[model samples]
Target: MSTSTSTAAADRTLVTALRERLQLDTGEAVSLVETHISWVLLTSRLAYKLKKPVYLGFVDFSTLAARKHFCEEEVRLNRRLAPSLYIGVVAVCGSAQAPHLGEGDPIEFAVCMRRFSEDALLQRLVPAGRLELDRLEQFAHRLASFHGRAQIAAPESEFATPDQVGRPVVDALARLRVDAGARPTRDLQTWIFEQRKALRTAWFARQRSGAVRECHGDLHLANVVLIDDQLTAFDCIEFDPALRWIDVMSDVAFLTMDLEAHGRRDLAFRFLDAYLQHSGDYAGMQVLRFYEVYRALVRALVGRFRVRAGAAQPGGPDYLACATRLARMPNSAPRLMLTHGLSGSGKSTMAAALLAVAGAIRIRSDVERKRLFGLEPHERSIDHPTNIYSREATERTFARLAECARTALQAGYPVIVDAAFLRRDERLLFRALAAQLHVPFSILRCRAGEADLRRRIVAREAQGRDPSEATLDVLERQLATQEPLDPGECAAVLDVATDAPVDVDALGARWLALSLPPITRRPAGWSAS
Candidate 1:
């Protein structure tokens, strides 16, 4: 038979087999189009994915046995995020012409999954203005929750170390070197080395801190769908265990980078903020930028290779665009500016404004300390003299705040610490730590009139709304003992007055000017809206 005839025959066989496997009574059609590593068929209610019999450098499913194993692996890995979507693996039985779903001898394997609307994908939705920020926040929280419960492989496992996890990225860059010419390749190599060094420390720290876990290896927006008001992440990397077992932040960085690529950076910030609040794994922030850059470069290399290979596949252009975007991920680290003030000074409001510019993690010491004591934010404690506001309790509260700051900083996140900082020693400790870690830090000192503070305290007490639990007398006492920050202590200071419209934008602008280099600064009128 001719080559055309053989190809036509195989196509018909695949169509017939899909009908039998899916129990389709109607004359539903199927098209077996080959992808990079799999064959996908669009069916009425589901999509059947078959692993190709090919052995790539990083992935192998060349043999029938190997294919079946990976088919099962796909089901196992994807079920983590899309349990309801990934049905199971099905065996192709009998002869090619008259193949039955479960009859006769088994010949091939396929992963069966529920078909999702293509438009529901976050990537497509963002461009169409159909993606809601609140939904994205919920999705971020859900993904974080999933990672929290995911299993962490042992240190000896292939997925445990940065080198093992980054092998695919390293290999892709090497391949790109051949076609990118000398200069681009050299620049890419330098970036890769820096990324590897930073990520290695983060990876090991995560392992030691118990933040490494089995996660969705491929978390791009296209893999996520909004179905029935819930975000479903599917199409996980199934061929390699090393890819899937990773620090949770690495998995999140993929989605963050994808969101940024789609020109939805605001949504990206919202997503990261929600995820941090849900998981409380602030330490993961340290490695976020590195992983995002790595993921972007990997996409770029894949695009270059695809263009060279002349594979005009679906998402080819997207891969290239993604790569271009990835090359620019390491422009700068996020900035964090802390704010301290007395009651009615508008520190919380100022911190909230900064969130629009930088995805700032705002940690309120008042609320956290209340949580620690298992008390309501507005609940008053009986004056035990030694229990509620003792020197030891105050020290513990500062320690907790510092710990939270450290966690957020390590996770590659910027943070805003909101507190009174009435003690000079307490303020200096934070400043010293920030200097030691080499992260940019600042302070916004909010001040208002005495009458305003008194009125605000009274209003708060009446509304049963504040965690500070300060009475008029307590406020007066606090004023007497509050030690002013030394001129040399803070990087910047902002005056937040209740009577004036808080110039938060100006404050944020000043903060950007003080901390960020010219290259890292956002363009004029950048909204923290």
Candidate 2:
């Protein structure tokens, strides 16, 4: 018999015996799903994942010892996100001809996990219209928290720089062209290389500035599920450290690329906004599009691999189209909008809403102030006198905000300066900056009743880890000294009442539907209602 035939027969025998030997009370039989590198046996409420003896440039599992070690690693890493889902690993003993569970010497290793209904997967739910906005926001916050806690990749690590990080993308594109003869991937491939040329410098700077970290490497819809009413991510890359240790934006780009591939670009925007809010990592946007292109092409190449292996993957072409769309994305000219309000007047909330709908990058006082102090966004109350909101410190904070806004605006991205722009000079500084950049400018005056604002100040301070350090005294002082907009600013001002729900998407759609040139395309999920 041929070698391929012999291997297939051996695999079938091993799978059948595994189903019989593994203890499960599935009334009838267990179903097995085979992927390129692993076989997953599904029981009533359990899953057994056995790695194939596959060798690839990224990973090697050809040896029995290698499989065993990776099985243990999978359990250790995935438990961080899905502790309850990943149970433990087990040894398959006896023989491949008639294998018995844990009887003789170890032959194969399997990672056992608690399996739940597949319908709850975010991949499935998004297409079916069951994944709501609130749930997506929740998932974003959870992922942001995960990134915050993840260990930053050391500078000395081999995969700690952009050239090293993009090696896989380069390799994947080469494979796609070689396997998919005359597939017309040159245009898409050309655009990807162009973006590489544009973002190569920023990519390295981001890694040097600590944006690189150990992240959930394979964060796609299929690996994420809504378990027990919570969105849970599992099955991270375990065999390859190069894939797992990456710039955080590269990790976020994978899911967004997946969503766009499914014809759901609207959710992709929402997810990105939510994650940016929670993580306060706006600087990483420098390389976001670069990674998005890379990630989309990776999926496209994988689809081709499946097709060449005689597997049915009809969505492969759609993935390639997504890659081209991402690469050819038009650069929207920068625009500036500053928030006008006291500390607790809902400026941040309005800013977040505007960002979600308008596709604007936000620069916040609370975040940048801390950044000026070399502190994390949530780290507060250090260097009491110098960090205690002195006049000099406040000026320095706004200066840093302007610097950041300048960089983002010059890069052709719309910006939202999310600060308590109570001082006339501070507000005027950004307005002048917008004029200098020759972009449309607007001021969002976020107003709320004093009673509500005062209450909110107390509540916000009570919530520990809040970036804002505003107190009752601060609120009262702000109310006393707040300046009104000048008559010259009237034509470009927007008054926003923060007392109720504000669907900024719909509002933005209506406001920019005519007369105004939109900074970004309106979301398909929203209308001019």
| TM-score of each prediction | 0.75, 0.84
Per-residue alpha-carbon lDDT of candidate 1 for residues 157-213, written as tens digits (9 for 90 to 100): 656577765676676666566664312445556666777776687677778776778
Candidate 2 lDDT over 1-529, as tens digits, reads 9986787678778878888765444565688889878999988888999998878867898788999999999999998888999999988888887775565698888999998888998878987899988888788888988998989988777664756756666776787678764253677777666666777788778877788888899998888998878899999999989889888988899998898788776678779877876676777777777677788777777777667788854543367677777666433446778888887789887777666566567888887787676666667766545654888989998888887788777765678888888888787777667666666777788888888898898888788657888888888888799887777666677778887777787755533332333553222232221
Error of 1 at 395 (Å): 2.8
Q: Which candidate number would show the highest TM-score if scored against the true structure?
A: 2
lDDT value, candidate 2, whole model: 0.78
**Candidate 2: misplaced stretches above 4 Å?**
23-28, 132-135, 148-154, 160-162, 174-178, 181-187, 263-266, 307-317, 329-331, 343-345, 370-387, 448-475, 499-503, 510-529
Provide the clashing-pair count of each candidate structure: 9, 0
lDDT of each: 0.70, 0.78
TM-score of 1: 0.75
Q: Give residue 358's lDDT in candidate 1 (0 to 100).
A: 59
Candidate 2 differs from the real structure by a C-alpha RMSD in angstroms, to one decimal, of 6.1
